[model samples]
Target: MSRARPFPAAATLGILALSACTGPQSALDPAGEDAAEIAGLFWQMLAGAAVIWCLVLGGSVLASWRGRSLWQVATALKVILWAGAVFPTVVLAGLLIHGLRLMPGLRATESDLRIEVVGERFWWRVIYHRDGAPPVTSANEIRLPAGATVEFILSSPDVIHSFWIPPLGGKTDLIPGRTTRQVLRPTKPGVYRGACAEFCGASHALMALTAEVMTPDDFARWLQAEAGPAAVTAGPGPDAFLRHGCAACHTVRGTEANALVGPDLTHLGSRHTVGAGILANSPAAIARFVAHADTLKPEIRMPSYAMLPETELRLLADWLASLR
Candidate 1:
């Protein structure tokens, strides 16, 4: 008895699976829009090659089934070889040229705003360039105008580090005594997550940041507030902020803390992350760092003053928070 032929479901499923494999659109795939276009072009080339392969292989099989002479096999081989060699070369060359043209836009420029970003031991510093010589300072969070051009000039205070903002652009390494730059112009206004792409030291994994893209007016107001002095201080926190010798490593503009060994905390309250984005910019987080800097960040140069009472911690946090 003759056996029944198999159903064509296998071939149909294979085709569908092949189609699904061609579109690359996930976070794990980091090529951005350019990669998708390139993948599409590659799929087209592959489909053309697949068609030739099926035609040649199927013709050879059909010829054998029909009891044609072996010479028909040689003809199919010649057609397959010539078509495979000529078509892919021409098509790939065209794709390469087309891709090269798109490359310039991949590195395109925009007249968006410029923001200078600095990397530190456990935090980040940002300086918005204005018409005059603006004071350099550090904020736990970065705010930018939506649809603005942001050119980050990255440099490290001590060791080498990397800056990465996932939604807007790729990683750029910041080296000591050198400046590296990346430009970004996000169309949407929202928060973007960032981290230190390069391993700096003990606390490398914990260092993270947020990129807050805001409306133009809000950004301007933030700049103005940062340019001004810390809000009026009136409690024990002010005394502690001074007596505790925090100024030796941090500088608050218009204050005596002119130290440059650490970040310029002139606008600390306005920032959202602390210790180089290791922790949130909240009263509890700030108090924890002040009380036990080593527990939160091991081997950190900043010494802990955990002996301070919770009331004092709250006072310090309130004072720092009032700086906005």
Candidate 2:
């Protein structure tokens, strides 16, 4: 026995009233090559609803305009049973199948590069694994070869967090003691922003990261530079970095500080933002972050270094920025 109820004309009008909730224009909309296919299937579901709404509302207007009695609602009900209920169910089920069919492509199977992103209270540590080579580590920055499948294994050292890159895909949770993997193939060459979707603690707002998708050749060059050790500490930039005990918590390749407690600053100079992802990767921003990090993000494990003179802070920031 069929138990489906016919939808009313008013129901169709109600869906149209909510049509504004559909996909709105935004910079955050993932516009990757694969995104079109994803978006197409999504909008098809929306279109099905819109079409049903139009038919129901239009049929109501036609029925009323034809001098039919409002009591003839039974006839309208019969039409809705055929068009609204029977029709939409078929349409929606088909759309669901179509959307689900794209899942295999989302999951990678080819030779994909593996990168592990670890989220903490106020920072992100990105570790890239290369074949037959040592791991490359950096803070709040990730670079990948365009058109390659980069599988990101996400985890949190402490609390729960979420890794979200709007232009790439959606957010994936980073749970402590568990690894969540997200695979993304970069089709476009550009810098993409990411953030911690879930609030972990006081510095949650400041925790952010960036994905720098580049040409295969450009990515190769970056990897080469990262594999090398820091340049000679002859200048005031490297001099101040060492003399000030900055290496105590941070690590630069071939330097004394190899502690994994904090993010590796080997390539800090190449990043676009500092203090996690709260501020732009500029000299002033870096200086401000290193100086007032504790105040800017209260309860941060890092101590305030603002007691240093502005001139020394500027020099340190400049030297760090020159790292890349």
Candidate 3:
């Protein structure tokens, strides 16, 4: 028997890289009810297009090869009528109606939780609302309970930005001065990547966030912890933060840093990433961001503290990390 030829290593690598399509950020891998519906619609349309393509193109090739017989001409005309016009009309109309029917059900009748998300220039301002409780404000990351319907009321303080969590729900535009709502029922407990799908401005590519879907009990615990004020400690970090006039733009709960120009840092230590998910939430990463934020994220309004002493920067990173 002849030996089969081995696949090239580069081709194998390419195939392996395609696995990224099904990763946590992929629309092909639906982890929530809304994404599943959208994926289903996409697959159905793709299959229909493939069938139409085969019928139209294959029929044309066959007609050209077969002589100009009356039978061939009649058959080609019939195929053109059905595949080119009738089939497409019927298929598109059906898909349109199916999509319309799916829309109303996608909006959950009863939401287990409500979150107000405001799109800033390059970050997300998240407010978790509770019944008879003060809103818990955070930034760049959203935590939700798996297997629960959560409603997001989205708006923009500046320009338009689209909120899209591929594995969770569809894209919803955050229009300034207008509130848009989207409902998501995440079925899996994992971190889903989200970003601004619309082109806002400079650093729009860096405008990303993480959606942490946890079990109901764990979500409750996290919510409680986030609802409280920032953890106070006897450290130089808080002093350094204040001394540098960081309070003029950012806010850390239970302190005098109540400026609304930037993101809330009350639970910054607990977040998975910093600088709008541009960096991992580590001491070194935090220190680098605090010292040279503009270098990492250009055009950001937060000024760089590259002149600060290394010791003070380290203390500031440690203090922020200790908030958890």
Candidate 4:
């Protein structure tokens, strides 16, 4: 009896899966110095594994099919001893030493920019520590100057979360009451997705952030703008945002909406996403999130304002969108 094969389907699926290894969040498609070294290590290890696999499997097939005619018992034993044990040991030891050699460069701490990223529930609170100025606070999104080494001081206030931007570097856990530092030198100016790699709560999977790498001049302009107050100071949206008790949690630097319970809304309109990357940054999305945040992100700390009138929601969303 003969058996049928599914090689065509398997081959198609394998190609599709491999195609996913080259995107914004792919470690294999690294865009930074640390990530490039990590990717190199991965490829080297993969090559070593492939060589070992081919040799071991080929030897097994040859032994089962034609070994008796080709080798004496003593020679076969010698082959098994060296091939099964000694070869793997040497290869793995070499790989380990190569991996260890990369640690010092990856762990270098003398950075040009310092940013503190705090994991709170399902959102990221990003604070920029400038050289000669007070720390600027933002949320959900991080911007870095391309070609500069940036150090991130990571921590969590409640539970453990892992800060990982695959295109840049490795994952660093954010443990409560303690800090973990990771340095990344971004070489590309593009938007990369970041996420919490640890499972923390009901909405852990939705905890995502955007990291945009910019040129030095552009980053300076952005930082200057972000350090300032809200661009839209007075309007119907600002009025509704404050009048409906939104000020109790959020902060809009130029206005009276100064509270730290929620994400800093000082430049909320400028970000790419709402509710920490759960929704696109638009007037309608903002209105929907403001009215139903709990539904959009499960078990979140933000209270829902489902009762807000549609017109008011639109106004507030417009005001926030104009804040840039």
Report clash pairs, candidate 4: none
What TM-score fits each model? 0.69, 0.80, 0.93, 0.93
lDDT of 3: 0.89
List model 4 lDDT by residue over 159-196, tens digit each.
99999999999889999999889999999999999999
For each candidate, how many residue pairs have backbone atoms clashing (under 3 Å)?
5, 1, 0, 0
Regions of model 1 farther than 4 Å from truth: 1-110, 233-235
Q: Hey, what RMSD does candidate 4 come out at?
A: 2.7
Ranking, TM-score, top scorer first: 4, 3, 2, 1
281 in model 4: Cα distance from truth in Å? 0.9
lDDT of 2: 0.77
lDDT of 1 by residue, 1-324 (tens): 966545677788788775654221222222234334444555676787798689878877876887555457788678667766876788678878987886654445664555677777766777777766565455546777876666677888788889876655556799999987776665556665678889888888767777777788887887777777666544566678778788888777766667776667766777767776677788777788788888888777788988887787888877776676
Which of 1 and 4 is ahead in TM-score? Answer: 4
Candidate 4 stretches with Cα past 4 Å from truth are: 1-15, 67-73
Candidate with better lDDT, 1 vs 4: 4
Between prediction 1 and prediction 2, the one with superior lDDT is 2
C-alpha lDDT values of all predictions? 0.70, 0.77, 0.89, 0.91
The pairs that clash in candidate 1 are: 112-149, 113-149, 122-275, 122-276, 123-276
